[model samples]
Every structure is written in C-alpha cells, then in structure tokens.
Target: MPRTNRNGADTKFRAFSDQTRLRILHLLRAGELCVNDLVEIINVPQPTASRHLAYLRRSELVITRKKGSWTYYALAPAANAFHKTLLECLGQCFDEVPEIQKDARRASKLKQQGGCCPR
Candidate 1:
C-alpha cells in the first residue's frame, strides 16, 4: 500500500509556483473552461495546457468534468480550511497583477467571440 502524505502545503505551493499554472488559475477564477479555451486564451499548445492542468489536478487545486470529447476544469470547491483560505488569498493577490489581468481580458474576449466551446 502506498502512503498518503498528510502535509499538502508543499504540493499546493508547488502548484502555484509556475507562471502557466498561475495563468490557468487566474483564467479559471472567472469560471470553468474547456481545455481548448485555455489553450486558445493562453496561446499555448493543447498539450502544454493539458500538462499544467494535470499538475493543478494532482495538487487538488482544481476539479474536472468531461463533456463528450472536451474536458472542463474549474477551481476545486474548498476541500478544507487551509485550501479555502489559500484560494481566497490567491484570488486577491493575483487579481491585481498586470499579466493576470491581461489574461483575464483575453479570456473574456475569447468567450465573447465564441472562439471555442461556448458557455
């Protein structure tokens, strides 16, 4: 049997350490989005987006749903006290960053244009 690590602070911190992951989390702050939408908005390749998303999933920072061939991801509902507060802090801190703001604008425009899977 494999041992489950009790301390997830390191895992959560690692999840927030990458620029791509941070961008993804900022994008997801608006709402759930498909992998294609993330790829388009972030201007990265499909595999790149998937790879970062996988990292987020492993960190238990995001949740997923599959519709047909598309997979959608959103911030995971607060799993516990620590994650809840951390997510709240992340939202507040990233909301003011210029790069994150730009990414949100791009994502908003893409959604408005129906660039990918429509909401």
Candidate 2:
C-alpha cells in the first residue's frame, strides 16, 4: 500500500503536490525534454530545474534516459495516463476556461520553438 509517512512514495507524492512540479508536468505533457530545456523554458536556474525534475523522477511522473553525457526526461507511461485523466477532469470542471485555452496556445508555441524554451 502507499505509505502515509515520510517514506519514498509519500515524499514523491509531496513533490508532485507542488505548483512548480505541476507546471513542470504540464510542460512535459506535450512531450519529453531535458533539464536544460526545462530551465530555458521555465526561465529558472539549472539547480531549480534539477530540483523539480528530481522530484518528478522520484514520483515516477518523469523518466530519465541517458544519451551520452546528457540525460533526457519524459513523462513516464504511467504519468501519461494520469495526465490524460487530469485533462479530462479539467475539461469536466469548466465549459469555457480561457486559461486552459491560453495554456494550449503557449504549449503550441513551445512546440513550434522546438521545445528549446522561450524564456
């Protein structure tokens, strides 16, 4: 069962429970990326990006693969299902949320920019 104490799973849940991590998840919703990509896109420092990513990894929300000297992170397959469910819930919550529309636009722009980040 999932733990209720300060165990690994609980700690990971706490990590994903943060706004920053959620934003990172949202960004990763469209596709996979690296820490540098996140840093540039989110306009945060390398350490900040690393912290959020580490949390996501611990939560199994993100998966990392090594490519030579670099590590690329993407939403784990498990995370994809959860993300889909989240979008469905959000869709149910609002008939016309401008914020969601705006976010979609931004995400589109990010994708067009090669996900290198526009920050």
Best by TM-score: 1
Candidate 1, residues 26-89, lDDT tens digits: the string is: 7887889998899888889999999999989988888999888778899998888998887888
Candidate 1, position 104, lDDT: 85
The pairs that clash in candidate 2 are none
**Which run of 10 residues does model 2 get worst, by summed lDDT?**
87-96
* TM per prediction: 0.90, 0.64
Each model's lDDT: 0.86, 0.65
Give the lDDT of residue 32 in candidate 1: 94
User: What does candidate 1 score in Cα RMSD to the true structure?
Assistant: 2.5
Per-residue lDDT of 1-119 in model 2, one digit per residue for the tens?
Answer: 85464324455557656756766766676677777776666667999889989877766667888877788887766435545555454345532455445555666676677765322
User: How does residue 12 of candidate 2 score in lDDT?
Assistant: 50
Candidate 1 clashes between residue pairs 3 or more apart in a chain or in different chains: none
